[model samples]
Target: MKIKKILVDSLQEAIDITKSTYGDKATIMSTKIVKAKKWLFFSTNKLEVTIGIADSEDFQKEFSKEKELYSEIENIKSTLKDVVEVVKSTKQEQKTPPPITQVQPQNNEDFSLRAMNLATKLINAGVDQDIARKILEDSCGFDITIGRLDLKYEDDYQSLIEGLSKNISLKAINFSKNILSILALVGPTGVGKTTTIAKLAYMYKSQGFRTGVITLDSYRTGAVQQLQSYVSLLEMPLRVADTPTRLRECVGELSSLDIIFIDTAGRSQYDSVRLKELKHYLENVPSLEIALTVSTTTDERIILDSARRFSELGISSIIFTKLDETLYPGCVLNACIKANLPVSFLTFGQKVPNDIELANYENLANILLRGLS
Candidate 1:
């Protein structure tokens, strides 16, 4: 098997290039729009498409084996590097003599320095300053014994960091007694709510559940069509409801289905009139779980504000999208912690059923510490 990343001006060009290079048998792995630097002060946008092809059965087996071995080796290397860093730090600390002080240096200056360093690390990772400070205060004690910033307190510092990273809340979907569940997604424009709904529909359908999708996003151009593309491919039913009455009717019709997902038009969080209209549609719906979808690549302030304003719609959980577009994952933790909501799902790329995952606490913590790059 062979893989190649092709850059082109448009999706059509990418498709043509892949077909010309690898023939019809090639599989498109992912597609993303990125800015390419054409000059020092200017940049142009281009489409990046990763495509793969399998030459033969033997080659596929060889490729799979080599990929697995390479992944294992990389994991081993990362673990060894971390171990080496800890060993080196310990050795350096032993070699240097501790500064002599009558009272063991449990002063405000030492505590302030340590807190500032931790806050700086968090802020550099895209976390809000207030959120970072709150995390530090919540995770570490203010006792004099905890004020030392030396080798003797190295383990304590490490534990404090780990505890702070675990502050994110994670929630899982609950399938009701009759095997019928209703989930609605709401968010701002271009945050991938439609695509995420498609992904969730595909995931549930693949699990042998009778799934149905309904969209109330008829206002957005091509929104229904985008979702229809996926539903049509999966042979699932899709209903477009433009009003509360239509939505209720659609829900009634899909009652026999095991799982039903509702997609809504993206509205600005500041648009209270439209938000109230949306609430009217969902307020009476029984057992409906609303998930507020937000992009991880967005600014931390916007994320927090979106979470706050969307809470008016009674958002039950958060669904973070576009994780693959950003290197800093700390915004996810910051948003969730600030909103006091649990994360339900994470969408990383454009692939249906492939890029979405159930939120895992430890996996997200690792990503926050070591970015996707």
Candidate 2:
């Protein structure tokens, strides 16, 4: 077996380097925290991971061997059991009294049940329990008096949507008015920021706006080349910004264009150094607008944290990406409400220009109340 140790600032970075270096057969042997050079005037803890892999083809081939039908069936059964367990756990969570603050009358059983049911739906859709309860109390709270209930629209889909959307802040970008605008997208890794940037660039280019894209994702393998491919197909200008100086030059070169899109490297939300580095790079660009691209598939708490930190970098609006990958799309509402920022766009798929749209906050509420529309 061949063993190697990798030292990186974050565990995710170590795992990524391992996967790209040794592929599937690599086995992580051990991990430990190590003191790293001081950063941001303080010492940051870094992780050192030790990994091992079989050195011989014969040993490696053992893993590549196909499983028997019996083994496959057993694996399928195990997976199905896991899914059932998850469903049961979720249902149990739904039944429990939520830990959210209650503002309405506690004595009214009927009112409490109705409010709890609505809050449960939001929770199932990945909305934070506290925010969901607030929505129930503030927007959807219906009184069941001795004779009449004012919430006749409770059964209506449109009303539910309007209620949830009203609880959060939403902003729509006017692409036509973004003429001569330079926008930058920053987010965590694997959130489809690059593809979304390409989609926006193409959409504007097709609309007869001279749209251009500049990528600062120089560290990722083939990042520049991928965006360059789209630039060639669209016959639009593409620039690579490796330094703040180069970024300024790229902006000047594309200054006459109707829209300029800056594509930034995806960094872990915990990696504050790189986030600061991103800010230092873009702070010079004139009238620059920053958008945070986040994924609905991400854990709700992580989405909240990501939004908070990225918002520190002056992200005016958010773009929720990979909407098609998650059933619980409430991350949009959760981030917007918690971070107190407006969502500007939504990308559902990998298709260029077609999969992205101006974000619909009501659609989020609609999906939470009912299924996808």
Candidate 3:
């Protein structure tokens, strides 16, 4: 083993010098670029070039005066050669040893590149790459292949959904064709229970389903008022229930209506006692279907936990909200898988009736595939 440092104006010049001096027998051990000049080290058959300061007379003067620097470099080369010789001799002495041919991960850039490619796979499989990467890195302490992303679709509209579906059996309350004249929305806080009810009301009224808006969210200031604002626009009747008994009475009175939209207050899954109380209130409302309202952008773990908690309250189906906030929409997939819940609808934006989608499979599949591409 030999170490030769060649100073040249360019990498090409350095390569030429290396080839001319040692032909194909030389290899570059290491190379660096500094300023305008090139510094190259050649070993067996590979050439490593470093560009050094070309225009700086000071660099040249320092190089010439620094005898200790040259000595240090030489010493390093000598030590490396000795080590190599010792390793070879030791290996030869061994009668039989397992061959070690490891694939070397070169640098940080190489690692990140591998991770990015893995990220692409997760995205392709319907997992959001950014979130997946963060989750993988955080939980596993290493980036892993995005594995087994499932797509979910709702079958309520008789429209084929093209994503993964979980078999978590929520007694789905089907209201697609106005079969039931009255319907109620219920769920924990900010689950878009209000907006989803509004969308349903608009759809029912547009189709001449004789829709009415009912609210059990009057306890929260402005909650009832918000429903009123929309009801006023549609010229629809609005009923407010401060207690479950009132909700039961309202349901019976509204039985004659073609379709009733019930909006409930949002609550957290962790608030088990309050949530149970809320559930108990709606328990006697026999004619209403309690659909679980979920947000698409929340953490996947939280979504699963929420669904598990809500499962006790008898969620018929899920209405996923805020689809526009997440980059990779795989959280929906995770939710469905964990809760064994079917999707009924997805809300992409805050737009009233316009932004809501009926969780159709084909359309979602195409969108998810396009994102992967």
How would you order the candidates by lDDT, starting with the best? 1, 2, 3
Q: How accurate is candidate 2 locally (lDDT)?
A: 0.78
> What is the per-residue lDDT of model 3 for residues 168-270, given as tens digits with 9 covering 90 to 100?
2223345544354455565657868888888878976887777887787777889888888888888888899888888778777777777788887888889
lDDT of each: 0.79, 0.78, 0.63
Residue-by-residue lDDT tens digits, candidate 2, 152-267:
25553554555666687667665554457888999999899889988998888777888889999998999999899878888898999999999999999988887899999999
Sort by TM-score, top down from the best: 2, 1, 3
In the predicted model 2, the residue pairs found to clash are none
TM-score top scorer: 2
Best by lDDT: 1
Q: Among all windows of ten consecutive residues in candidate 3, which has the lowest summed lDDT?
A: 151-160
The TM-score of candidate 1 is: 0.62
Per-residue lDDT, model 2, residue 282, is: 90
